[model samples]
Target: MESLPHQYSVSVNAEKENELETTAPHLPTLLVAPPSQFDGPGDKWSPEELLLAAVANCYVLSFRTVAGIAKLDWLHIECTTDGVLNKVERNMLFTDIVTKVTLIVAEESLRPKAEKLLKKAEQVCLVSNSLLSTKHLEIEVVVGG
Candidate 1:
């Protein structure tokens, strides 16, 4: 890490009856719109989906760093995140978020260590840590050739 505090910037542009264009420095622009639940076209990325994606992405990256430091050999890892939005009082917010992680290793002996590392990753994920919603993780370690 470069420093204790890092900054990020993104810009979003939209016009009446037009799709939203989102861009960040040195990154490709993304098309965003409201999710189907809000009566949007449901054909483009939504802020809600992006939020969940950030959680999943951060978890995977955290796991990679944790596994690398531990010198644990692994083949592949997959993470799927689901978020539940609900109305609380007069506000709307995510009530729960769950991430299902699958990790592949070469030997059965790695299962326990893999499980431990997965949990550790969740503990260290900054995105999930920042969220107020309840978070849950389901982990599966598989021995693969």
Candidate 2:
């Protein structure tokens, strides 16, 4: 038996001078651009940042579902991602992405299970799975914090 494939799409409208508005049905419009270091607006979301964000967001959301199914309860989940870009030959591209996930749980005994769920989440994150760059995961599980 085979599973059905799913497709997603978004539209980007150019809004003059390195700024664009990205939109999809049922989602809020996003202002996007290159980073200020690349002569784009500082206040808008950069393509690099958005790429990292996609990775981080995928992991956390995946974790939520995995943790729930695994009976791992947490007080909070915070994920931060950093992307490293370098000039490779002549073009600049992301070389690596590091995602740090901090989970706050009420009981110390749940740490091991939470850690496992984090690993599973990374394995299942669609965005990270689709990226060609290297991804590093840092997991921090805190008890009652």
Candidate 3:
């Protein structure tokens, strides 16, 4: 297996009168709701954004960890994640999430190593692992040297 099995969990608390002010143990209190386009508060973080953030964040961290293990060094790595939400049947669901990973290396010889690490990162990201098959994920890796 590429990764070992692991378990993680978090607890959230919200008062009856204030659902927006939800807080989790060991985490900051955040206002949760739908996107502003759906009449939700514009100033708060929406669930969709949170989901995509998790994927993007996980990919970057995974890449770093893999690169460290592989002894591959790069100047920088940038990942842009986008989620496509569409109406399916009677519910709105995310049909696809696309992540574009760009890697910059000081030497041309590191390009192949960077690409390999980036692809491994996309495959090993925990957030992407948790997603169902219905949610399609596409990852693109671009290496610059």
Candidate 4:
């Protein structure tokens, strides 16, 4: 079977002054990362940090898409993600990512609908599926406060 949508690119250049390009004409910048907090070597973002962000960002995008598909109207949305890095097998690498999504809807009645959107978001989350084990997702729907 073939994927429905195809053709996408994210270009990153260490020597290009943190410049990038995206095939999606609608997208402005490809994406930017300030490298690691520890500045010693490696001119690019660390693999672990990239993994964490990828999972995080992918879910957020997925959530938004799902919300629109499910007819969910929201005022604000915030999310946080965590990846547990450890040594698996003989080499050291990432283990899993846990994403927490906080959704604020326009009205209290939309909370349940928002929750359903989150579920669909998880389903289309490509980053989550790339991982090996289950990635724990914590979703919260807040009405006003």
What are the candidates' C-alpha RMSDs?
0.7, 2.3, 3.4, 4.5
Task: Give the per-residue lDDT digits (tens) of candidate 3, residues 100-145.
Answer: 7777777777777777778888778888888863434444444554
User: Highest TM-score among the candidates is held by which one?
Assistant: 1
What lDDT tens digits, residue by residue, belong to model 4 across residues 1-145? 3687766665544555543332345665444444454352455455556678888889989888887777788988888988766777897556766788888886889988888888789889988887886588889998884
TM-score of each: 0.98, 0.92, 0.81, 0.72
* 1-145 per-residue lDDT for model 1 (tens digits): 7986999999999999877999999999999999999999999999999999999999999999999999999999999999999999999999999999999999999999999999999999999999999999999998995
Name the TM-score of candidate 3: 0.81
Q: Model 4 residue 68 lDDT?
A: 79
Select the stronger candidate by lDDT from 1 and 3: 1
Q: Candidate 4: count the clashes.
A: 0
Error of 1 at 74 (Å): 0.6
lDDT of each: 0.97, 0.89, 0.76, 0.74
- The per-prediction tally of clashing pairs is 0, 0, 0, 0
Off by over 4 Å in 1: none
Query: What is the lDDT, from 0 to 100, of the residue 33 in candidate 2?
Result: 81
Return the TM-score for candidate 1, rounded to 2 decimals: 0.98
